[model samples]
Target chain A: DARVTQTPRDKVTEMGQEVTMRCQPILGHNTVFWYRQTMKQGLELLAYFRNRAPLDDSGMPKDRFSAEMPDATLATLKIQPSEPRDSAVYFCASGLVSTGGSGELFFGEGSRLTVL
Target chain B: AQSVTQLDSHVSVSEGTPVLLRCNYSSSYSPSLFWYVQHPNKGLQLLLKYTSAATLVKGINGFEAEFKKSETSFHLTKPSAHMSDAAEYFCVVSADGGATNKLIFGTGTLLAVQP
Candidate 1:
């Protein structure tokens, strides 16, 4: 069965460390989304890419957070000088968006990040 | 701008009892709505979705939801609750009724199944 794959299921880093989370969307899916889950914020869409092109990143923190889709299979979310407040679970989801598609998303097990 | 409101933050039901989780949405136009369930330490799974099709949508795991345009509600329901059904349920709305549109999620409702 095809599924979205995420690296580093759990990560712990001290404040000011650079953190990177990677995702490999299911093959044949054309859209990838990054979402952050937190107790205070529920689920927030950090960014998304369609057809390997960045579609939106307005919800991401421009100073520290960056998302890129270098190719069709790989998507990355990076945080430079990560802070303690950034501790949360990040999820990557993939979907096949088409005229007759259901618009459903297949999510990867999230990457839990803790910045001390 | 589209948004969803989960009426309850928590709902507890005994096994074999009927379950109801209420949700209301606000949108300027016809919208696509969905229900997602997240188990502890797991990713969110799609339960069901409504895209202006039939008013009632049936989903996996014996779960279903009905979309009410006049009430602006899409409430999830299960005839009999099970212990395995304990999870966080979120109501989601597509900002623009498209796969590419951002999905606005409601604060989840934690469902507890008691024996």
Candidate 2:
């Protein structure tokens, strides 16, 4: 059974520190998505990549948050000078697009970030 | 803009009882809908999806949902509930006219199973 893998399943950082979360999508999936989950906001889409290229990242805060897909296997989401409000569970999901469009997204266990 | 709304913030059901989680959607075009469940401290898992093929879509774990176009609803249901069914459920709608397949998520419903 193939699954999406994530690094640093739990992270605790002081405010203003930089936090980096890594994801290894399923080997053959062509689409990758980054989402942030919070109690107040539910799940919010931060960024997504298709075929190793950034497709949509409008939901990401350009000033502090960034997502990159340096290669097909690795996708990363980084927050520089992270704030207390940035404390949330960040998830990475990947899927393959069939004739019917994108299929079910396989999500990682998520990196839980706690900024103090 | 496409949006999804889960009617109840929380639903409590006893074991062996029926389960119903209501969801409603708004979209300009024919849209794909999905139900995802997230257990405590875990990632979201896809339960089922409706992509315009069949109105009644069966999902894993003995759960299913029906798409009602006239009502703009895709409510999840199960004949019998189990203790393991407690989790947070999200209703999602796929964005229209995009090869990227962006999704709009609902606020989510927390299901509580009582023994």
Candidate 3:
């Protein structure tokens, strides 16, 4: 079974530290999404990429957060000078949109970040 | 723009009993709705989806949901509940016109199964 793989399943960092989370989307999938989950905000879409090109990153804080797909197999989310409020579980999902215009997303185990 | 609301923040059901998790959505045009379940320490898993074909969508783990356009609802249901069914369930809506699959998610409902 193919699955999206995420690195640093758990991360603990002091405030102001830089944190990087990595994801390896399923082979052959072209669409990748990054989402952050928090108890107060539920799940918020941070960014997404299609064919290794970022389609949107409006939900992410441009000042501190950055998302990039260096290549088709690797997608990364980085937070420079991370704050305490940045603590959340970040999930990466991959999917293939068909001609029908609909498809299901396969999610990674998620990287749990705890900023002190 | 589209949004989803999960009616209950928490739902408790005993094993062998029926299960119901209500969801409502609002969108300007026809929308694609989905149900996802997240277990503790696990990633979100797709339960089922309704993409304008069949109103009644069946999913894995004996769960299913029906799309009611008139009611703007796609509520998840199961005949019998099991202990393993305890998890956080999210209702999501996708934008119309197939531009992108970006989704708007609900706050989520926490299901508790009692033995």
Candidate 4:
């Protein structure tokens, strides 16, 4: 069975620390998405990739946040000097189609990180 | 721009009662609408989706949704509510016939089922 997998189900870090969250999307899925869930912002798209290439990342904070797919199986979100405002649940999701226009998203369990 | 709005912030119903979660969307182009449920500390699970295929769409766990293009609404419903149905529900929209795959999500509505 193929499922989107995420690491560090829970993480606690001090403010201004570097944080790296990783995800493994479902096998053979063409689209991968990164999202951040916060009480104030709800669920916000951080980045999106298709065929192992970044298609859009306008939702991310350019200076401090970066997302990359080093390989087909691994997608990483790096936050340098992560702020307390960045404390929230990060989710990695995959889909069958290239664009959400096709509809339906398969999501991972999510990686919860608390910035103290 | 595409966006979704969940009409209700919270709804509480007794078990075995009918369930309704309202959603409205705004998009420049025709959209593929969806309703997703998230259990505590879990990921969002697709409950149902509405494209051009049918006005009414049925999904897992007795959940269903209707796409009213004219009204720009896709509301989720269930025949009977269960305790396990308690969770956060999100209404999302994406351009079905457009170029991008990005999804715009609603703020979310919390549903509570009482035993």
Q: Report each candidate's C-alpha RMSD, comma-separated, in the order given.
A: 1.2, 1.3, 1.2, 1.8
lDDT of 3 at B94: 78
List the candidates ranked by DockQ, beginning with the highest.
1, 3, 4, 2
Encode model 3's per-residue lDDT on B1-115: one tens digit a residue.
Answer: 7889899999999999999999999999888889999999999999999888999999999999999999999999999999999999999887653456677789999999999
> B4-86, model 1: which lDDT tens digit per residue?
99999999999999999999999998888999999999999999999988999999999999999999999999999999999
Candidate rank order under lDDT: 1, 3, 2, 4
lDDT score for residue B104 of model 4 = 80
> Lowest summed lDDT over 10 consecutive residues: which window, candidate 1 chain A?
A96-105
lDDT (Cα, 0-100) at A57 in candidate 4: 94
Error of 1 at B87 (Å): 0.5
Which structure is stronger by lDDT: 2 or 4?
2
Error of 3 at A91 (Å): 0.7
lDDT of 2 by residue, A20-66 (tens): 99999999889999999998888989999989899899999999999
Task: Give the best candidate by DockQ.
Answer: 1
Which regions in candidate 1 have their CA more than 4 angstroms from the true location? B99-101
DockQ class, candidate 4: medium
Worst 10 residues of 1 chain B by lDDT: B94-103
lDDT of 1 by residue, A1-116 (tens): 89899988999999999999999999999999999999998898999999989999999999999999988989999999899999999999998888845567889999999999
Classified by CAPRI criteria, candidate 2 counts as medium
Superior candidate under DockQ, 1 versus 3: 1
Q: Report model 1's chain A TM-score.
A: 0.98
For each candidate, the DockQ is 0.57, 0.53, 0.56, 0.55
Pairs clashing within candidate 2: none
